[model samples]
Target: MFWATGWKPIVLAAAMLLASASSALAEEGVPTPGDLLAERLDERLGEQEVALQAFYAARDGRPAWQETATVAALANALRTLDADGLTPQDYRPDTLVAAHRQALAEQSSPAARARFDVQTSQTLLTALRHLQRGKVDPYRIDPGWEVPIEAPPLDLAAISQAVDARRFEQAFASARPSSASYERLRASLARYRHIARQGGWPMMPPRSQSLRPGELHDDVLLLRERLAILGELEVMAAGVSAGVEPQATEPRRYDERLVAAVERFQQRHLLEVDGIVGPRTRAALNVPVVTRIDQIRVNLERARWLLHGLPDSFVLVDIAGYRIRYFRPDGDVWRSRIVVGRPYRRTPSLRSSISHLTINPTWTVPPTILREDVLPRVRRNLGYLWQQDLMVLSPSGRRLDPRDVDWWRPGNVILRQRAGPRNALGRVVLRFPNDHLVYLHDTPAQALFAREQRAFSSGCIRVQGVLELAQHLFDDTGTEAEVSTLVAAGRTRNVHLERPVPVILHYWTVHPDEEGRLVFRPDVYQRDAALLEALDASPTR
Candidate 1:
């Protein structure tokens, strides 16, 4: 009886248990945790060779995250992945923890524990990938979007070291994005989820037409409630409901205040700023709160892709919003209106460095543009080339007469436009070394910037204040006076940058406005639905 406190019985008991475990493992053909983990890796994911090799190569054949304390830590971490808009079921941390407990109780086999340990390592890897690069492959969602090759796996051996007691949570968190914009969106996502849990905003009843500002109908009451829940309508007091109109005076009246609120909502949605709710405004307002919640979630996924390792100075182009923002380390240096690709020809998400700037740039139409756009126009009017200040060049770069060529037939003749004020590529062009052959340049059509939705380009982006952008890029090389002189000279000039600035062209339908109110834009190319569907199918990783 007193042997409970003695060391001899304990040592013998441990020896017997080890002998039994060894016999059982040999019977199962898995002698150690490493052998079981390897067997599970081969059985479950034969194609995940890279992850498997990376996972085991670091641990010297031991389970890095499969130990009891480590797995419990991972379980706690996995439970909170929803805070970052991730699905907890994707990791199945509860099942892993439960199985580990079963193994400790001798109810589960060593194989089960080995399987849990292997998958937990895989879960860490997959979750890290998600935190760094987004859930779905951006290129698969939209072929125009550029996605880099898979980055090397993290140093899991170091992360799982006993000396570093941060566990999976703190260790894996090192891969998360650390940007202010991402943080702000994360905060907004939490608030929106809270709103969702509270039953979200009410759905507006369908009417044949929209409710005007001055009309006094029951639909107007619903609209008031809708705007109040959307945070557009300002309440009179903390306790008072913003949706409630003043009682005993005018229960059914569209006062100027309501009209103003409607206008604000329209502005938030990039709709026509008319106080009256028309069909377009009505359609926007009728979008369900759940749909907006999904929109926020979709954009949050995109935010993860661009969150980390950004340059000190860079440019961000919001494709759907038709805006460009230049940033330094501190804040936005400048912002300009931009025209992105049309519905058919969308501007793709790109991440590239601006290597050089081109002044008095010439426009050479791409083959696709020539085949689709120029050919049709030329077939109609033979004088299109002369009118548009364009010329035809043969294969050898010699000028050719359009009269001698057949406009109906397809050929590889290049269309070159001269460098001038009316040139398609206005004064300066910021060139990125890419295979896509798309560059940011100026445009003469300044009036288009005044419109809310500006998806008017073929594919290349057209900048409003392109001169300022050029001058900004030419920071140490030259001055505004020098660039102005160069532009006036009318000769083609290519100026190299001392240090290239990074440029990212991305798309997002929802973002917070200046006042931190969520604003939405039209899915110009109808991309949101496709992306949402892709996200629905993106859980395999």
Candidate 2:
């Protein structure tokens, strides 16, 4: 209990009246400030009462916000909650500020001061919690999403002492996400908001056919304006491609410079870099700025799920972008093109640690693939299994002849592909433990990676640089040499890593490019609507 349990700042007469009450509190046991808070919290947030009680009980009834006197320092930071794609209305800092002013003016008792402190601190804490972990539950949108359910560990004592030292703003600032990646996304979001205020990007006309160089049309002029607005083309008069003077501002020819600009836009949008405005490129051009804004918000929500406690070194597989980024202490050390699951058989978002690597791994046909992909082919052509070098295995591990089983009837037999060139698992596999049973592996169908949209796999990820990834994962030890030795032996081999590396398979459809410009990827699984719906609805359940 505080030394002056009932002492209150008041006029001389009220001060004298509190002297006897303060002495009486000392005679009896003073109710802890934590108890006073728990009493009120039990009425509003019953679930949080225990945690709040434990947090303040250790402080011996002293108020955490008593010395801070005002919350004026937190006004800007609180308002930034909206900039970070969160609703500032739900976590209003003004409420706490008003409470602090009222508590300071209270001339009733010392217990009154303590209760106000507890209530204010909890509101501040609630705001910080919502900032770090978004209000919407990932499981509600997609049950397969492996959300880290563990709440962020609270540093209540430190926060209390910091507030007591009049460092309330700095104390709560520490509670926001600490990931640089998330900060980058937030910065991009802010920049886009600025762009939105400026009337957003130029909208191009929907081209029914491909636009080629040397073509002069009104649509070409519109394309030039749009591209120039997006910073991919220089704003110049028409006929530059033909090296002729133009009387009007409208473009009269698709010059080489304009072709180069279109190519750059194509590259940025993850389309074929042919400098031609085909259907795909035209579609990318037509995506509205509002949709991109929603994409940024959706990805911001996804980022909150993993911003805390990231491994210093890890492999990030972006399923929607179909790419893998290996991050080290410095930054992204390596990257690779990848193929993820098809739209109907979407890959799950998961976080796990890479345990080991396998050389010449055999591919087991999963039940879903066996039923959907192989059975149709096997029924149409009996020699499908032989051509693919796959075999049927009985329950007792006996290799059954393909003719012995009827392809039309679903059976308990397993389809296993031998470790060879035709095997879908390819030459190497990076194994990780997760309930989804998915892993990163090399693919014999390397050509698939060159396509603009690479979601062709059943469920597992097919990496273009799996061998390079294996070499890097083994570089921590002399395992690189051992891996070479094992590959030379030409057999199925499992190589344990010197230390397991954390792997996160996530979906982020919007991220900034190297120039800090926001880049958007197609939502292959059509997931943005559901996430946007969740974000639009009240996050508080």
Worst 10 residues of 2 by lDDT: 1-10
lDDT of 1 at 359: 87
**Candidate 1 residue lDDT tens string, 470-528:** 77777633433357777888889887877778888888898776667777889888878
Evaluate model 2: give its TM-score: 0.83
Q: Write the per-residue lDDT of candidate 2 for residues 424-500, one digit (tens) a residue.
A: 89888999999878999998898998897799988899999788788888885345445556667779988888788
Off by over 4 Å in 2: 1-47, 54-60, 64-76, 93-119, 147-154, 161-172, 234-252, 328-332, 477-481, 539-541
Off by over 4 Å in 1: 1-73, 107-112, 147-172, 206-213, 236-251, 329-332, 476-481, 538-541
Window of ten residues with lowest summed lDDT in model 1? 234-243
Model 2's lDDT to the true fold? 0.75
Residue 198, candidate 1: Cα error in Å is: 3.1
- Provide the TM-score for each candidate, comma-separated: 0.82, 0.83
